[model samples]
Target: MKSLILYDSMGGNTALVAETIEKALGARAMATDLVKVDKDLDIDVFDYDLVFIGSPVIDWLPTKPLMDFVKRKMKAYARQGVVKPSSPLLPGKFGVSFGTFAGPHIGEKEALPMTMWLNSFLEHLGYAALDQWLVVGRHHHNKEINLSGRLGNIEDRPNAADLAVVEHKVGGLVDSLSAWCA
Candidate 1:
């Protein structure tokens, strides 16, 4: 099945996560496409069987560019009647939302709001929202700033530990998809 990993990263944390996912899926022989979200990128969300949308949380929400792309795609889906409640959801279509945050908050309190919003948007567009991932990233610009959370002082976040979890999640997702298809 074909997959897509689309992301926006300012400090490169989210990009690393996106690329890691792409690599993991490719290692399993799955065809995957990676795109860095930008004005020049012309993405058709319906072209893929599985999609991973990721971004670094900015001000507790997706970056403006990411939100703009999502809004635009959602509009197109709605125009095509792909987002209507009556349209049957595609059983094989799935989406995962991921985010990196430097906020000191723990657990769901940190990134659930943004990630869940993303998941809901994907579901609205007719894809089953499979899962969400939240990884702690370092505050690259300045850890001294009060806004930087728990691991803010540390550089290289979404670090080794965070990446291991991402890798494991990808493996599990791939295995589950294989089983479902089989």
Candidate 2:
């Protein structure tokens, strides 16, 4: 099955995770498309069987650009009459929402809202929300937060160990999807 890894990163942490996910999908012999969310990004999410959407959690929400992208897509879907009141499931379509958060205040709690928001959008579009991943990332601009945050010393986060976990999860997801499809 084809997959899409779409993400937005401000300090490269989220981008790294997105790349790891793309590599893992390739290792599983899946055709995958990696797209960085940008001002000119234009693509149909329905073209892919599985979509992985990610962003860095900023102020307990996804980065503004990513939110804008989702809004644009929602409007387009509405105009096309593709949005259903009940959001009936579209067979063979699935989505995974992921995010990188420093969580200076409340640990993983800071990232949950962002993940849920993205998943809600996917569900509203009729794609089954398959999973959510929250990866700890460094608050590069704020040394105090990076050193004393709830996660503690996350400056080197989304590091190799974190990426390995992401890869392992991708493999599991692929296996699960295979079984589910069969």
Candidate 3:
């Protein structure tokens, strides 16, 4: 099925997850496209059967660019012909939300709510928000908060193990999507 992965990252952890997902989908994906959300993003979310969105959680929220993309795209999708009159998303579309966070205060807990917010954007667009993924990243801004350097020690977070998990999740999601697409 056609798939799209959109991401915005500051610390690079979220970008790694996005790239991993793109690689895992590979040739099985009819057309897999990866886009880095920015001020000039020009995309049609309704064009894809499956969409994976990710961002770095900053201050308990998604990066501003990612949030802006969703808001802008939702308006654009509404004006598109393929979007059903009674539905928010194109029929038969699905979505997944993911994020990375370096919360020295609560570690992975900080990533959860942010991912949920990202998923809600898809939900509002009538897509069945399928899953949410979170990855721990090294905290650079506040070394004091990361006293133990717990997650900070890992030089390259969203590292091999984290990527492997992404691959596995993508495989599972594709399996389920295949059944639905068929």
Candidate 4:
């Protein structure tokens, strides 16, 4: 099946993960529609096989724009109805949430605050979150950053330790999504 993956990156970390996923899924996946959250074509989410979302952590929470967008989308969906009978693909629609951040360690619970919350929202709304990824940085330097988040996003330039933690998080997320997709 095909899919659409979109993300907002502050230090290029989130974008890196999105592109990697596109590569992993190969030709069946879009491979190119990696739109910045604020600048984009209007999302006709139902037209795709899957729609994946990514963002950056801001103060240990999801970027505000992402929250606003999700709210808008859910409202639109609820007003329009969660699923349409004529569109079977619409019912099984899958979502994935991710983020980039520099933060206090949470040991076994390595996660960006915003992404973690978004994952819960998706589940509570009854949508399946297939892939979740988190990219990290230790400092706030764009020279070390490579992407955008929050619409007006934040970039946490990572220290060596932060980079290592992000790597581990992404690995676990990849496995999580793969299992769910299978």
Best by lDDT: 2
**How well is each residue in 35-115 modelled by candidate 1, as lDDT tens digits?**
999976777888999999988887678888999898888888789777888545787899999998877555336677788
Model 2, 62-143: lDDT tens digits are 9898999999999999999999999999999999999998888898888999999999999999999998999999987899
Better of 1 and 4 by TM-score: 1
Q: lDDT of model 3 at residue 181? A: 70
Candidates' lDDT values, in order?
0.83, 0.93, 0.81, 0.57
Using TM-score, rank the candidates from best to worst: 2, 1, 3, 4
Against the hidden true structure, what lDDT does model 4 obtain? 0.57
Off by over 4 Å in 2: none
Task: Judge candidate 3 against the unseen true structure and give its global Cα lDDT, from 0 to 1.
Answer: 0.81
Please identify which of the two predictions, 1 or 2, would achieve the higher TM-score against the true structure: 2
Candidate 2: 10-residue stretch with minimal lDDT:
149-158
Clashing pairs in 1: 104-149, 104-150
TM-score of 3: 0.86
Better of 3 and 4 by lDDT: 3
Mind giving the per-residue lDDT tens digits that candidate 4 earns over 1-182?
44666666665666666666566555333333566676333675555545667776666666666667667776777787864434333255566786665444441134555676776656645656665666554335543322433222224333345445545554555456557667
The TM-scores, one per candidate, come to 0.91, 0.98, 0.86, 0.62
Q: How accurate is candidate 2 locally (lDDT)?
A: 0.93
